[model samples]
Target: MNDQQLLRYSRHILLDPIGIEGQDRLLGSRALIVGAGGLGCPSALYLAAAGVGTLVIVDDDEVDMTNLQRQILHREQSVGRAKVDSARDALHDINPGTEVIALKQRLAGDALLEQVAAADVVLDCSDNFATRHAINRACVATRTPLVSGAAIRFDGQVAVFDSREPNAPCYHCLFPEGGESEEVRCAVMGVFAPLTGIIGTVQAAEALKILAQTGRTLAGRLLLLDALGMEWRSIALPRDPGCAVCGEGA
Candidate 1:
């Protein structure tokens, strides 16, 4: 690290857990974030600011005025623009040194697998079940650590899934593919704006810990938050031996 880099991340260097070595690891890491909405916004913000070597943001949606309520990466003028474009620009303004790849399309099949395989970590910030399951499958395939976060209405949840671990529960294990989950959209059911930030920030922390090899990650636990009640709870997660994606028979 140059003199400027030392100064830029001097605070991180002071931490015992993420000292110079850990900060250096963060600087050499690549992360793929699978959304540019509320959750993705804060995750991207902190990862970029922390000097992650490379950040890949994927999204096919355009910025909407309604999204501004929580998606801090987009501004009023960014409306109508592709979300990835706006997010890339915003991340650049924060840390031009960090390479940001903006893919303005929904990643699926080989495309998604390729990105997931290339990344050191994957953050599932998308707000849909299909995308979450797909991301989990790709992460499990690559043995990459995934930091997942979601927020709808006044509730939010976060979890870390590391296929590298023998019995870490994946997103599908907790919410099965064929399961009956009432899909709730922030558009239909109003979401508390800060709720997204809280969950996204936790995702960022988990991702950084994974990259820096700091404390133990939430590999076998799920963090849930009720913004309305202002309470937080954690649930232990167990891997499903019969999980189709990560099962031995698969």
Candidate 2:
């Protein structure tokens, strides 16, 4: 690292777990973040600030007044513009040294797979089941680490799925695809604003720990938060032997 780079990331280097070596590893990593809304915003911000070498953010939505409530990456000027572009601008402002690639479209199929394959870590900050399932599949196929998070109403959850680790459960292991999960949007149910920030930041923390290879990465655990009740809980997550995505059954 150059003198300026060292000074910029001195705080992270100060951590005994990170120090200079882990900071360098972080600077050599690539992270792909799906979604540019509430969760994606904070996740992208911290990853870039921590000097993740590259960040590719994907989203097809345009910023709106409603998003301004929790999507801290966008501004009044960003409304009506593609969310990925707005987030890229914010992340670049945070750390111009980090390369930010913004894809302003809903992604799937080979396009998503290619990006997932290239990334050292993938973060599922998207809000829907279909996208989440796709990300899980790609991560499992490529043996990449995934950090997933969700927040709606007063509830939030975060989990890490590292297929690189034996017995680690992918997202599909916990939530079956096309299951009974009713798509709940903040637009309809109303979400607590800080709830996204809390969950999003935790996702960022988990991703950094995985990149730095320090501490546990929440691979087999699920974290649940109830902002209304101010309570937090953790549930053990086990891989489903019958799970089609990560199961013994093909």
Candidate 3:
């Protein structure tokens, strides 16, 4: 680390757990974030600020007025712009040293698998279930650690799935792909802005812990938060022996 790099990340180095070694790991890690919306916004911001060496943000949507309420990575001036472009600009502004790769196209199938195979950690910040399932499948196949987060209306949830761990559960283990889940959107449901921030920040924290190999990642545990009720709950998630997506059944 150069003199300027040391000064920039002095706070992280000050920690007993995260000394120079941990900070260096963070500076040499690659993180692939799917989605540039609410959860992805803060997740990308903190990861960039923490000096993740390479960041790849993927999202096919364009920013809208509604996103400003919760997506901190985008500003009013960025409305109507591609989400990946806005995210790239914001993250670069936060830390120019971090290589920000913005993929404006929606990734799936073979393309998604290739991306996951290259990343040290993958973050599922998408809104829809199909994309989430696809991302989970890719992560499982590559044995990559995944940090998943979701927030809509007054509810938020975050979890870490470490495919490298034999007993760790993937996102599909908790919520099966074909299972029915009501599609809820902030567009109609009215989300609490900071709720996304809380979950997104946790996503970043979990990713950093996994990359730095310092703290306990949220593997095999799911965190749920109800911002309106001001309640937080964590549930133990077990790897399903018969999970179709990532279980013993091939």
Candidate 2, RMSD to the unseen true structure:
0.8
TM-score of 2: 0.98
Q: TM-score of each candidate?
A: 0.98, 0.98, 0.98
Question: What would the per-residue lDDT of candidate 1 be over residues 1-250, giving only the tens digit for each residue?
Answer: 9999999999999999999999999999999999999999999999999999999999999999999999999999999999999999999999998999999999999999999999999999998899999999999999999999999999999999999988887888888898998788898998999999999999999999999999989999999999999999999999888988887766
lDDT, residue 111, model 3: 97
Per-residue alpha-carbon lDDT of candidate 2 for residues 109-224, written as tens digits (9 for 90 to 100): 99988999999999999998999999999999889899999999999999999998888888988999988778888888999999999999999999999988898888999999
RMSD, model 1, all Cα superposed?
0.8
Give the C-alpha miss distance for residue 195 in model 2, angstroms. Answer: 0.5
Best by lDDT: 1
Query: Which lDDT tens digits does candidate 3 get at residues 135-184?
Result: 99999999999999999888999999998897788888888888877878
Ranking by lDDT: 1, 2, 3
> For model 3, what is the C-alpha lDDT against the true structure?
0.93
The lDDT values for all models are 0.94, 0.93, 0.93
Model 3 ranges off by over 4 Å: none
